[model samples]
Target: MYCLNVLFASQLNHKSILKLIRCCLETQIPILVFESIEYETLADRNHRPSHPCFKPLLFTNRLKIAVEIANAIAYLHFRFAKPILFRIIKPWNILIDKQNIVKLFDFSLSVSIPKGETHIKDVGRGTMGFVAPEYVTTRGCFNEKCDVFCFDVLLFVLLTGQEITDYLRCEKGNKFYLVYDVKKYFVNNRVK
Candidate 1:
């Protein structure tokens, strides 16, 4: 098993971030860092989303992994005292060790809510493909549901193995329709 020789201990400031990492560590989730590469370098190459080796894993094991990611996000947003807006939720921000268990990394863009704030503003940021449409177009107020929207998009890409742009263009109307169209296409193609 790969071990993170240097833990990013300084980045673990928020309660949610600390808790999430703790749970993963306790449960023996493989989230070690490779000494040779920096997280920024991995993210720059889009290792999580577009890597050829990881692509197959997306198709074969995405559903289970998505569930785990959702649970992790849910724990941060709802279970914690102050919700954490993980502004960046792309696959690149997540790390996997030899065990294939996911560990979320890169806390550079993360934001924490105070006890009473209903929403956050002045933070216009997110990854490209994984960002929600409303957030991109309107730059309006957002909450945890915005992250959910991104999650849905990620799930679609993993299942279909098609670029998100293709799905968006080919499948029109609502987001649900788009997702349905992509899934249907994949299913039909597989059968043929």
Candidate 2:
């Protein structure tokens, strides 16, 4: 039910998105599209505004959402003819319709890997905090393990309500030193 973007070539091909859509539909999940421009404008303005829209559902169905996302990812990587690397797997990429069923979306950076290819590219892409350490340092040579790392970060965020980037910064040598120092001060203040 979603319309393809006319200007930008989708990172997710028709076949891949269609397959996932079909799987989701089979499981009784409804996929609907809103005005693309309006959606983008609103999303850009406040990317992480806390809304109570899905809070109750999220807390009540945490396990189900986790399992569904895991299965959907596993299916995309292992069940498909060629593994589709969903380079961005953040919470914002996930959509839940009125039925509370999980449908993965926003495959803007997805890549299809051939059977023998070890890594997709020498340069890393995707959200900074979700990126794998090796990919960031070595500038390449990442696999499903990279996705696993991102997934772990997402899981941490979902469970703790604390941003992974916040934790990553406090570990030292991260770019956001001032933000991390402020966070550390608050944390230490609370402990004492």
Candidate 3:
């Protein structure tokens, strides 16, 4: 793991972009330091659709972002010595470079599954709408599947250009969630 970390750091250093380090402190926390560069957060970009600097994401661009996020999660869960579950997957945690490359940042909510353990149990933690149902119902018993579920929700937002908690304003000022609306539409065969 140490060697792989060094190799990744050196390769990223060559490009002067990212630097990964594994510090053997008392807590054994791994620190990732990214080079300072002008970049836009995915949340900001998506939410500021009418901003002067906001450039609309093309369909292909959105797909590219999704693929990049999936690859990052795959690396964390498969390539590392200890598989990591990214408990929080949201637009706010994603950044887009000038080249439109998606960078998945923020590891604060990530947890590494103990060796020989398939899942971990803890208090459920994550943004509300992006959290997996099982994780919530099971009181935070989760595996990589939780991450996949959150990724699917993020994909829904990416494809539909709708926030997970999107609300429909009615005559009485009542609100309904976008997810519920989608579910209702599918259930009633109105989506077709």
Candidate 4:
């Protein structure tokens, strides 16, 4: 059975295309359903402060959004009989309802681990900075940990109000790696 939740935002003007995937608990029957919802993507809500449609995301709301994202991912990873790995965990794929609850859509890139395996190997596919380096280096050999890595990068985007790839590209010019640049903050004790 596919675990599904439908959300109706009370006051959103723009319609967003979202992909919902239905999966069997014990088997991988990838079913795709297209639904149009009136809501804002997390990328827009977080980064588009100067836009006319911008809604100020409060600090408390940011933490709440983070927790909600975590809960959704946990359900996908642990609640399902066959664990689903959400290969892409970027802001663009995350939607926020009018009530500020996060709606995780776009299961197009998700994969379920085989019944007796700890990981799966596939070709890497994700946004540049959001994709984990180790995942790319191993040619898409990944498990649940890969999502965790990407989620951490999402946290950075939420906090900084900037997309990692865009920010790094503008600042560093040539080399713009999310993990490599984030590591510099930790090394220099700049993360406060």
Task: Name the candidate, 1 or 3, with the larger TM-score value.
Answer: 3
**Highest lDDT scorer:** 4
> Measured by TM-score, how close is model 4 to the native structure?
0.77
lDDT of each residue in 37-60, candidate 2, tens digit only = 212111211234356433334454
Winner on lDDT between 1 and 4 is 4
RMSD of 4: 7.2
Cα RMSD (Å) per model?
9.3, 9.2, 5.6, 7.2
User: Candidate 1, residues 1-192: lDDT per residue as tens digits?
Assistant: 123212333333332232223313454654533223222321322235555544335334556656767777786687567786666676566655433455555555556666888766644677556666666556656677777877776666555555565545543553534545546767888622
TM-score of each predicted structure versus truth: 0.59, 0.61, 0.74, 0.77
Ranking by lDDT: 4, 3, 2, 1
**Model 4 lDDT per residue over 5-106, tens place:** 221111111222244333233446533344556778999899887788877798888888888888777767886677878778989888887677777776
Candidate with maximal TM-score: 4
| Candidate 4, lDDT over the whole model | 0.72
Global CA lDDT computed for model 1: 0.54
Q: Considering summed lDDT, which 10 consecutive residues are worst modelled in model 1?
A: 1-10
Can you tell me which runs of candidate 2 are displaced by over 4 Å? 1-54, 57-60, 169-192
What root-mean-square deviation over C-alphas does model 3 reach?
5.6
